[model samples]
Target chain A: MKCPLCGLEFNQEDGLKGCSGCKSMGACGLIKCPNCGYEVPAESGIVKFIKRWRKKTDESK
Target chain B: MTVNLSRKRPQCHSTADMEIDARRSVVLVGSPNVGKSVVFGNLTGMYVTVSNYPGTTVEITRGRLADDSRAVAITDTPGMYSLLSITEEERVARRVLMENRPDMVVHVADTKNIERMLHLTVQLLEAGMPLVLDLNLMDEAERLGMRVDTKVLKERLGIPVVATVATKGMGMDELKKMILKEDILPSGPPLRYPETIENAIADIAKNLDSSYGISKRAVALLLLQDDHEIWQMVRDREPERYALVDAIVKHARERFADPLNYIITIERQRFINTLIEDAMDNDQVKGIPFRERLSRLSMHPVAGVPIFLGIIYLLYEFVGVFGAQTAVDFLEETVFGQYINPVANRIVSSIIPWKVLQDLFVNEYGIITLGIRYAIAIILPIVTTFFIAFSIIEDTGYLPRLAMLIDRVFKKIGLNGRAVIPVVLGFGCDTMATMVTRTLETRRERVIATLLLALAIPCSAQMGVILALLSGSTKALGIFVMVMGTVFLFVGFLAARLMPGERPLFYMEVPPLRWPKLSNVLTKTYTRVEWYFKEVLPLFILASILIWAGRITGLFDLVIKVLSYPTGWIGLPPEASKAFLYGFFRRDFGAAGLYDLKTSGALSGVPLVVSIITIALFMPCIAQFSMTIKERGWKMAVGMAAFIFPFAFVVGYLVNLILNGLGVVL
Candidate 1:
């Protein structure tokens, strides 16, 4: 995912900066948009999975 | 407006995090994996996986749906039971209702389980959320001999209800039309309880001057039952108004035969019964009865704990001993150690002129040598096996039953059954499990669970190595179990005594057990492995780089010197301190580090046992530390750290003292 601030993609969950900032902030549970220091929530995995599933199905069709 | 700390997570927070400002969006909300997401893809014209089952998505997703100027934004929400939140997913769903102020909500229910599903719809209606009810899986419902009366149900619900077979594109146009033309303004009739209760609610509402998004009556009912967030919200809105409201609730309790909340709930059920009478053809038969009976047995006290232990042993045998020991040896020793490492070392020695650059790639402790090797050869294979096993277990619907089974024992230890999720997840990886503690009902429960996880329960990586290390000696395994049990009980007892607030009750829905679908398990395992590999690799490399930097700067030796004193006090070798320190980096890495010590013959029986105990009870892995700070905040996280670091060694020292005093030889 592209970091909003840096426009760089880190092929990982949470922040791309190895969660250095969040570790300091003490909130590694939140998803850090890998590009910009944006912290999003980590909610239910199934819902997000299905959302992705829907997207894939649509694209294939 | 209150600043919701948990809000604004795009990736893990909310599906709509990125798309909130759009003119319109489709919010794909439903039960776990009912193809709401597949339907979302069809609507948005985007690429997303269409999997059978995997309950991993914890956040919202956004996409745009368009068909010739009928453009709308789409959001996929986590599965939730009701508007009255219990789980974090439920809280997120409720927050979406208030914050986004959606023009319409797609209440996707599995058409087969309409009885249980419609309870949430009634709550959404009661909360006055604008909704278009989509009965997804109409085909599956029909195949199961279930027929829903859509038109009558819509009339009864006072909203447009659309029948959708989402995977096949059934009823798309009707659903779209309902979303467009159905009244955005909710017309749900104000549900009335008996006159006695109605009179009480009217009194409560009249006194409650604070205007809420939900009706005051609903808020009043919630407040009496000690809904913390709702109580705080009302307190913030009208600081002086609580006394009178409290009096009203007390008065209602005196008059009511049952707890007012229970009474209100029963009334709501009766209301749902009448609605179903108009809208549903209730099916009395289900195919999964034997499965249901077995599922129930797994949770019963006599059978459940043994079943739980049996499952744990199977997991230990399959994932820990077998996977981490045998499979890992093959991958790490035979494949990577023999072929890859030698080849890479030769290539690096030949190519690099600078000694330091070569050191970074393939030296005694090179990033490529240790980091890449551990991540790929060791952690990769072990976690792959774990994910496959976990996926299979989850697919068979056994985990929830396991939770129910454990809830009884958990209660004795000052936790309820719901604590089972995070505790169980701790076995997978404590970092994610610590984050999952947000699903707990109260702060005290979260704190207690977090502490237990940090102190006693081994994350899967750590479990893998420790299980492997102890595999040779059955006595060693027994001692390990005994030490772990002692720590769990001692810490749990102290925490129960110290933490304030009453223990929250747990109620879980146990889905039926079945033979795990292979295709479903495979997909889930693959996705998890993808997610896991993404998490581990960089951290491993970074850990190596940091250790290298520490070495270059003399910080590593300085800290090792500091740790060695504690190491000696705990009756462990000085080198064991290095392993303990690195254990903070990643769990398995630390264990692997200890393997180096063991191979060097620096640690033997007593010290080895002490070291294992100490590491097991040491501070949480780095990821968990990060999550603890995130979920519980820094003061508590640091305080937990402050207690853990000193306390772990203290326990180790004490264990050594006891063992030595008893003259025990393993």
Candidate 2:
């Protein structure tokens, strides 16, 4: 996902990997951009479901 | 050929193997999201091993090229913009390049952003790497009516160039051919700095007795730019020669008005402009797209104020009128008041025989009647709507533009535009935002930002409750906003004047505004609301218990009596002192206390607005105070709190005096 602040695109896992040292311990539910420390909310299950469904439909098309 | 793909870190590569394969390896390097991964996939085929780099959590991917004949190993380094790194990813990427001394270094760049990408290219060349400039995303560049003369680019940079739409497999064969070519040599540095800098670089390089894998010239440049890693490396490697190099850097720095890094970047950018002019053409007219025009308008000084006000108005309508009033009334009145509270009271009364226990769970200030009701019925809908609105605004990419627009205003507060990130996030959660103040460039900026956040910025929960409390009177709401805004600016101005520090420079990228994706907005809102519930629900229950305990012990009344003196001085009723007490626990809890009083007809009109302003400007909650202590240390945190609490009441006292003195009736 693209970082909202600096526009750097990084994988969510990569972003989270760098956040291990954050004081919140990920309970804040924010995924910080690895490039800049800008925090963004992680995608929810509903969003993931919708995304997967959309991808499947696109592949079928 | 089966590629060895291991996800585990320890098993990925032995140190000896890494050293042995260094010469035959290829490392793909580029800024984030420039298609380096895609290019790596094309070269290495389906299977690749990913492991954490040694001593760091940053993942590094490695695989053997698909061509079994050469059996050349390829590693895809993390995205990095420059050798003088800031983020750990960039540092790891540079370490990979310098340590591996790869036979081929492919600098994958987005063709559409070649100008920005070339900054890294110039650095790589300066580092004397054997680089092949792969202009990825060719289709996107062409769609933008951009064309790059690859032959001219290759000729000018003295490196091989390949153009490819990596996702579509275009130019793959050529890229493969280039990677496979033997005898690729490091290109000479493409940029020559001013004479003073060049002479310094030469001087530093001549004194270097150690081989640092890369050219001594690159080390000199990194040292001149004050790259900490290079400084440490040079200090460790050339302990005797380090001082001589350091003196040379200091002498060169003395000759420049600006920082050496800035000076060097300007020179490199100038060289890149000429190179781009010679090798690139754009058939598309210079007409701004609608998005671009909108972005510009949003950052325009005069135009942006209305846009900012417009956003605030929309937020007021959505969160205040709709969520705070409509939804809150339904939940607080119909759901909790009519149904949940009655049932809870009955259940607790029937089960717990003692009146004290019963009151603890059901009566006035009861856990169920006040704590759960406030958390779910009052604060929930308001924060939900706020998070929704905030998510939409964030997804639209307007915050950075807002940052740019406010940069000038922020400078007066001794903060640059970057402080906007923490300041805006403070509205959501000041505790979390306090943690983010570390992003500010200077200690002074962080302290000021932290103070402003603690003082004037109301978190969403508190703002929502206050909005609901004042929703009845527009004049009251307007007064509340005006007072808070004035205090924010006045205090920040004073702090800036009092604090001694270098003036901060503001620079930020303003991404084009786009329609917010519903999925993204919903996801963000859901995550935030869920977090709020997890964090806040228990706090509410605990606050209720603590209040119950304090009342039983008579400690609560003593505190309330003492608090009521200042509460009365602010022209608030004695009952409002309870809210002020709660304000120390959580600002939103204090606001909710005011909400209860307002509903009961115990507080209204000017006193309501006065109490709200004072509470809004009160010291941050216990959590935020602890964070302040953590971030700023004990002395600073205590100092800020010591000044803030009295300052808040004093401001309240003054606003009350001026308003009543003017006989302005709400």
Worst 10 residues of 1 chain B by lDDT: B1-10
Q: What is candidate 1's CA lDDT for residue B118?
A: 78
Instruction: Indicate the TM-score of model 1.
Output: 0.62
Off by over 4 Å in 2: A9-31, A40-61, B1-26, B40-76, B84-92, B113-116, B141-164, B168-208, B220-285, B412-421, B439-441, B467-482, B601-606, B654-666
Error of 1 at B248 (Å): 10
Error of 2 at B232 (Å): 6.5
What TM-score do all the candidates reach, one by one? Answer: 0.62, 0.81
lDDT of 2: 0.83
lDDT of 2 at B52: 77
- The Cα error of candidate 1 at residue B589, in Å, is 1.6
lDDT of 2 by residue, B435-549 (tens): 8887665687788889999999998889777777877677787788778878888988888788765564554545557799997788888888887787789999999999999
Write the residue-wise lDDT of candidate 1 on B1-666 in tens digits.
111222222334323233223465445666555667776766655532221112444456565554564556566776666565544555565665665667778888888778767777777776666777889888976765567898888777878788888788899877776654444777654377778777776787787786676766667667655566787887788778777777877887777534555556666777876877766555534443455557767889788867766775676677767776787778877897789889988999999988877878887778888888877876776777776777777767676666565567677776644567677667666876686677565677788889888888897668767765664555666677778878887888788788745554455444435687886666666666666566678888898898888888899889999999999998987889889878989888887777657645788787788888889888888878988988899999999999999998998898899888888787
lDDT of candidate 1 at residue B403, scale 0 to 100: 59
